[model samples]
Target: MKYLLRYQLINYLRTYKYVPPFSIFILIMVVNYTFVPNPILNSYSFTSIMLFFLMGWFTITLFHAEDEGQKIITILHSKGQSAYYGSLFIVCIAIGFCLSMVSVIYPILIGAFGEQPRVLHIIMGFLSHFSLAVLAIALSAIFTRELVKNRQNTWWGVLSILIIAVAIVTLKSVILPVKGLIWLFPPLHLALEMMSSDDSLKNIPYVFYWQFAWIVIYSMLLIGLYFFILHHKRKL
Candidate 1:
């Protein structure tokens, strides 16, 4: 199992040879922060943009890697595919959390110099980031599988763009009472919660309840994917 994960890890790292897009994202974040006078707004905007880019590119790269190896269906036959997919998902979540930490801590360190930031806030930031990343990765995993399954769809590209755009817009509107249910989509809700200070809604309805719901849904989807590959292999 360890070797299987390492197999995927090594190949994934090699895929980093084409990392200029990520570098450009970091550059854009830095430029925005350097010019923006309002530190709080800058921090929020920077984190939001970075998360958006990360989720999109990470999804693209995962599917591209699988496609490059011509292993979409072949991977389903491997005894190690379950661990391989699960480990890849784990790695993506870790990368997302680490990136989120960088996004938050970078601004805090620069803007809060002398005014020590609270440890609790930092911890919550991580939890918020991890939960959202897990949610994003789960969706990406499912989407990649579907794309492979429906490779001939003429509108897949258009559908992909629309879905991502809707996700981003939905995330932005999460504070609206009726729209709060959109928070079930991890990254959107996390962004909404992180950007807002109004805890009055917490009394109205437990925020954690919705978050826990997403985590449950995401886990089940992952398990379903695993079973899918296993069942297909059995038939072969």
Candidate 2:
């Protein structure tokens, strides 16, 4: 398991999928903070739009690494199927947390340089972004697995882009059972609720806690689904 993890981490660093999205994220933050004086508005804009799409792309690329044929065989044989996937889940969680923290670093630095926001708000934002990133990683794993199963490797990037694009455009009008379904999408739900509030500190609203709870629940469900898919694929 340790060997497999080390190999994955090395591959992740070498391929450098982390670079482009992270670079864009930093660029967005710098531009917003430089041009727009209000730190609060900058944070809100970052979380609402740039963070979502960039993180989604990052998640997809990370999981897509598993599609490399030789590496997949090496993981299965050396680590055993279950241990290989268990290690992967851990890797994904760690990567998600790290990437999410990277996403928030600019905001943290801006706060440090003056324009201090409530500590509680910063904590909640960190938690929300971390949870959202983990959930995105799990979903991307599932999507990548399905694409591999169907032998549709060519569509991987295209499908990921389309999914994010469609979700952003249609999320508002989605209603009823569908609205309930959309709520399961952590990025959109968290962005809408957290950004909508005027009070970031003094009155830490009930909706923040409510959204956090849902994020935790949905993250668990997605992680479970990721493991189940791995188990089923191992059998076949």
TM-score of each: 0.66, 0.75
- Cα deviation at 86, candidate 2, in Å, is 3.2
Per-residue accuracy of model 2 over 1-236 as CA lDDT, tens digit each: 77877876777777787788778877876776675346553365355355545555666666656656865686657756567666666776776677566655666665532456676656656665676666555555665544355536524643564367436545555543574656544444564556555533576677777776676677678768767766786579
Model 1 vs. true fold: TM: 0.66
Off by over 4 Å in 1: 36-42, 66-78, 112-116, 145-187, 198-236
Best by lDDT: 2
Instruction: Score each candidate by Cα lDDT.
Output: 0.54, 0.61
lDDT of 1: 0.54
lDDT of 1 at 38: 41
Clashing pairs in 1: none
